[model samples]
Target: MLYPNSSSFTPTPFTLNGIPGLEALHAWLSLPFCSMYVIAMVGNCGLMYLICREEALHQPMYFFLSVLSSTDLVLCSCTVPRMLFLFWFNLREIDFSTCLIQMFFVHTFTVMESEVLMLMALDRYVAICYPLRYSTILTNPVIVKAGLVTFLRGAVLVIPFTFLTKRLPFCQSHVIPHTYCDHMSVAKISCGNIKINTIYGLTVAILIGGFDIFCISASYTAILRAVMSLSSAEAQYKAFSTCTAHISAIVVSYVPAFFTIFTHRFGGHTIPHHVHIIIANVYLLLPPTVNPIIYGVKTKQIREVVVRLLGGKRGY
Candidate 1:
C-alpha cells in the first residue's frame, strides 16, 4: 500500500474493527454486551431515582453516589450502543466528526467518573475521620464547586489531545482496530507525526490518574489511622463497614483500566488483539453494571428502600 503525501491528504471515514479476530462471533458477543448495557442503564438510573425519592438518602455520600451513577450512565452510553450496532448489524463506518465526538465524550466522562470515585473516597474519609466536620466541609456549595472543577478539568485537558488527533492526516488508513475511537488508536492510523498526541495523552492520563490515586490513598491512610485509634472493636468494625462499597468501587474502576493500559503498552504480540479489545470494553461497562449492585447490597438505606418498593410497602 503506497502512502499518499500528508500535505495533500483528505480525511476519510474511519472503519471501526469490533473484535477484529472474532468477527464470526460478533453476534454472540453482542448478547453479553447488550445484557451489560441494559443492566448498567437500569441499575444506574434506578440508583439515581432512589436517591432522589428517598429522604433518608439525602446526604453528602448519597449525593456523590448519585453523581457517580450519572457519570457511569454517560460513560457507558457513549460507546456501547454504537459498539452493539457494529456487532449486530456490522455497521463499522463512522464519520470523522462523529468519531471525534465519540472520542471526546468517552474520555471526558471517564475522567469525570474517576474524579467521582475519588470524591466518594474523600467523603468516606471525612465521615470516618472527621465526623463532626463532615457536613461543614462537604456542603452543597462545596460539592457543586468540586463538580464544576472536575468537569472543567476533564474538558480542558481532553480537548488538546482530541484536537491534536484531528490535525493528524490519516493518509495511512482510516481503519481503527478497536470498537471505539480512542486517542492512541486513531493517532496510530494517521500518516502524520503522532509524537505530540502520544505524549500529551500519556502526560494527561498520568497526571489525572496519579493525582486521584494520591488523594484516594491519602484519604484512606488517614481513615485507617483514625479507625485504628478507636478503642472499641465494634466501633472499628462499624467505621470500616462504611468504606467497603467505596473500596470495591475503586478496585473495579482502576484494575481493568490499568490492565488494559499495561496490555496495550507491553503485551505486544503475546496478547491477542481481541483480548485487548474485550478488556477495553469491560473497563467501560463493569463499573456501571456493578456499582448499583455493590451499593444496593452494601448500603442498608438503599437496600431497605428497594425492598419496600418491591414489596409495595408504604412507609420507610
Candidate 2:
C-alpha cells in the first residue's frame, strides 16, 4: 500500500520552448525550403546522370564533380528532410540516440564537403597553372588518392569529437532549441560535464574546417597569380571561366557555415531565434541547391547535355 508508483514514473516527452513568432516564421519558410530541396535533388541527380552517361566528360574534373554532387545529395538528405518534417508537423521531440546519430552524420558530411571543395580547387589550380602537366599530374590514380585522403580525413577527424559528445550525460532538460539536432545545441542541454565536448567541438572547427578553408584559399591565390602571369587574354579568360562555378559554390557553402558557427558560439537568446533558424537552413541546404545551378549555368557543356536530355525526353 506504500506508493510504489511514485518511484517508477516515466519521463514525459520533451517539448520545445518555441519562440513567439517561430510557428508563423517556420510555416512561411517551409514553402521555400521544400521548393529548394526539390530543385536541389533534381539538379544534383541530373548532373550525376549527365556525368555518368557522357563518356567524353570522364576526365578528372568531371569525375570530381560527380563525386561532389553525390556528397551534396547526402548532405541535403541528412538535414533538410528532417527540418521540413519538424516545420510541418511540430514534431520537435527526438530520441536521444537518434539525435546523436543525426549530429554525427551531419558533421561527417559537412567535413567531407569541405574536403571535396579543397580538392576541386586544387584540381582547378593544376588545370590552369600547368595545362601541359595537368594530364600527367591529375591521373586516375592521383584523383583516387585525393578522394581517399578526403574520406579518411573527414572520417578520422570527426570520430573523436562525436565520441566525446556521446559520452556526455544528458540528465537535464532534453529539449534542444534548434529545429534539427546539432552537436553544440544538444551538448548544451547535458547535465554532466560539457566543457570537454565544447572544447572538442571547437577543436574540430579549427582543425578540420579551418584547415580545409586555408588550403582552398591558398590554392586559389596561387591559381590567380599564375593566371595573371599568362600573356594571352583568351587563356586567362578560359581559366577564369572554369573557376566561376566553383567559386560561387564555395562562397555559398562556406559563408553560411561560418555565420552559423559564429552565431552558435556567441549569440545568446537576445538574438532572434528566427535569424538563427534561417542561418541554420542556409548552412545546411543552400550549397546543395546552388551548386548544381552554378555548374549547370556556368559550364556550357553541362548546359548542353541537360538541354539535350530534356529534348530527347520531349521527342520520345
Candidate 3:
C-alpha cells in the first residue's frame, strides 16, 4: 500500500530551492545569470528592432529570424526573472498554478523554437536548392501560415504537460530542487504513479525533436549537394556562408539541450543535481545570448545596416 497520507497531501505553494546545496553561492551565481539575461534581452530585442526598422530585412529569412528572436525573448523571460528573484531576494515560493503556467510557456516556447529552427532550415534549403522558385514557394501568406502552424503545434503538444503534472499528488515534497519548474522535475516530486507522465514526455520529445532533427539534417544534406553543384567557387562559398550562422545557432540550441535531457533521465546517482541544474540553465540561456551575435556578425546585410545606423546615415 502507498503511504497513508499520500492521497491527502496538498502541494499548494511549492518552494524552489534555487540550486539546493549551493544556497551560499546563489549570490555569486546570480551575477553570471543576470549578465546572461541582460545580454539576451538586449541582443534579441535589438535584433527585433533591426528586423522591424529596416525594409531591406523584410525578407523571409529575416522574418523567420524575427520570430526566432521573439521566441528567445519569451523563452528566457519565462524563467530568468523568477530565477533572479529567487536568487537575489530569496523569493522561492511559487504557487501551483503559476508553476504550471511557467512550465507551459517554457516547454511550449522550446517546441516552438525547434519548429522555427526547422522552418529556418527549410527556408535555407529552398533558397539554395530551388533559388528560382524560392520567391514563389515561400510567399508572405505561406510564411504567416507557417508561423501559425508552428505556434499551434508547440502549444498543443505542451498543454498536456500541465494536465499531467496537475493531476499527480505531490506527496514527497513541495520543494523543487531546480531554478524553475519543468515537467519532469515537477512530476518527479509526486508520490503517485508517474508512468504516464514519463511516457508522454518521452513520446512528445521523440516525436517533435526526432522529426525536426531529421528534417534539418535532410535539408542540410540537400543544400550541400546543391552548393557542390555550383560551378563557381565564389558562388559555392556564398551559398555555404549563408548557412553557417544558422548551423551555429542550431548547434548552440540543441546540443546542450539533448545533453541535459539524457543526463537528467539516465545519469541517475552518477550525475550531481547541481550539474544537471547548471547544464539546464546553460542550455536555456546560451542560445538567446549567442544567436543574435552570430547573425549580426555573419550576415553582411545586417552588419551593413548596423554600420549605417551608427554612422548616422539615412535612407536605409
Query: Candidate 2 — worst ten consecutive residues by lDDT sum?
Result: 1-10
For candidate 3, the TM-score is 0.96
Candidate 3 weakest ten by summed lDDT: 1-10
Task: For residues 1-316, write the lDDT of model 3, one tens digit per residue.
Answer: 4545543675779999989779999999999999999999999999999999999999999999999999999999999999999999999999999999999999999999999999999999999999899999999999999999999999999999998888788776999989999888888888888899988988898899899999999999999999999999999999999999999999999998888777766785898888899889888899999999999999999999999898886554
Task: Assess the local accuracy of residue 64 in candidate 3 as a C-alpha lDDT between 0 and 100.
Answer: 100
Candidate 2 displacement at residue 93 in angstroms = 2.6
lDDT of each: 0.89, 0.79, 0.92
For residue 7, give model 3's deviation from the true position in Å: 8.5
Q: In candidate 1, which residue ranges exceed 4 Å CA deviation?
A: 1-10, 313-316
- Candidate 2 local accuracy as lDDT? 0.79
The residue-level lDDT of candidate 1 at 64 comes to 91
Question: Which lDDT tens digits does candidate 1 get at residues 173-239?
Answer: 8799999988787888887777888778778778888999999999999999999999999999999
Ranking by lDDT: 3, 1, 2
Model 3, stretches more than 4 Å misplaced?
A: 1-8, 313-316
